[model samples]
Target: MTVTTRLAAAALLLLSLAGCEGMSRGQQRALSGGAIGAAGGAALGALTGGSALTGALLGGAGGAAIGAITR
Candidate 1:
């Protein structure tokens, strides 16, 4: 992507996070963990030439479970 596209994406992501302020701590953590995990999983899957969707689904589930438990 171009720099402008990346910057716009980042800006939108940050702006979207503002909505989380109304959620509980646990919900926020779970959402954060899921997002992080999905991102990581997609990257890893791409690097390993695996199915990104599967990896993301599994990673997101595990991350959200851990996040909810930890909270």
Candidate 2:
């Protein structure tokens, strides 16, 4: 990836982590899982010439469901 993309991803990860300060464990896990899933989905979609937004939405939903269930 380019330097700008790497930096942006790092900044997003930092911001996501920073937002977890006052959340409960389940909330934190759900948000974390959603973010990670969305990022992964977006990357995969881009590489495959698919819709990133669609991938992210689907991934976020799946992640949230799994996170909630596992907690």
* lDDT (Cα atoms) of all candidates against the true structure: 0.87, 0.84
Residue-level lDDT tens digits of model 1 in 1-71:
89999999999999997889899989988988888888888778888999998889888888887777794
- Candidate 2 lands at a TM-score of 0.69
- Maximum-TM-score candidate: 1
Candidate 2: tens digits of C-alpha lDDT, residues 1-71:
99999999999989977878999989878887887888888888878999999888888888877776785
* Model 1 bad stretches (over 4 Å): 1-7
Clashing residue pairs in candidate 2, if any?
none
Give the per-residue Cα lDDT of candidate 2 at 44.
Answer: 80
At residue 49, candidate 2 shows an lDDT of 100
TM-score to true structure, per model: 0.79, 0.69
Q: Evaluated with lDDT, which candidate comes out highest?
A: 1
Clash counts for the predictions, in order: 0, 0
